[model samples]
Target: MRVMAFDYGTKRIGVAVTDPLQIIATGLDTVHPNQIIDFLKRYMQTEQIERFVVGEPKQMDNTPSQSAIHVKGFVNLLKKTFPDVPIEMLDERFTSKMASATIAQSGMGKKARQSKALVDNISAVILLQGWMSKP
Candidate 1:
């Protein structure tokens, strides 16, 4: 089984998954908020997902940010949709910033740097990597 990760947003959600060996994480896709459950159902048909790791939006002072409310709702919905799969939350304060920086430093074109979907996809990769490396 593999671990899947989500960078949840109000509009688009970025997804990532680990290899079956539990190795590195790779960016999967960006799905609409309302379509995530169907998306996971499709994914689970071909892959065995052990758990889900969701980015928990937080403020600089370690308090849940405004986005956390939305994330919590998403989590609740996810749990209800797939009661068999366990979910985990990881702090996601600067993931977007880091992904932006990574894209800018990666020498991608100016247009690519401004792509929100690209940033979100990379953010999900970062979120999953963070979870996998957690001690």
Candidate 2:
């Protein structure tokens, strides 16, 4: 079984999938919020996803972030649609900044690093890795 992770945003959502063994998490792609369900439905035809790890935006003081409301709505829809697949919310504070730092250190050119899609993908990977590391 594979696990999927998502870094939800207003304009785009980053997606990542783990290997069948659940060892390594790899960034899959970025998709628009409106097309997310269709995208996942297509992806599900080829992949057996058992769980979803969604990034939960939160403030430093442990309060919900501005985007949290939208994320919660998304989560609710996901639960309703994929009733058999368990959904988990993982704190995603500072993930975007971390992804940017990682991209800067990776030797990618400024133009490539500036791509929001790439950043979103990396952020999803970061979120998945953090969730997988939890005991």
Q: Which ranges of candidate 1 are over 4 A from the true structure?
A: none
Query: lDDT of model 2 at residue 61?
Result: 98
lDDT of 1 by residue, 83-109 (tens): 999999999989999999999999999
Instruction: Give lDDT per model, in order.
Output: 0.94, 0.95
- Candidate 2, 6-25: lDDT as tens digits: 99999999999999999999
Q: Tell me how many clashing residue pairs each candidate has.
A: 0, 0
Candidate 2 yields a Cα-based lDDT of: 0.95
Look at candidate 2 and give me any clashing residue pairs. Answer: none
How far residue 129's Cα lies from its native spot in candidate 2, in Å, is 0.4
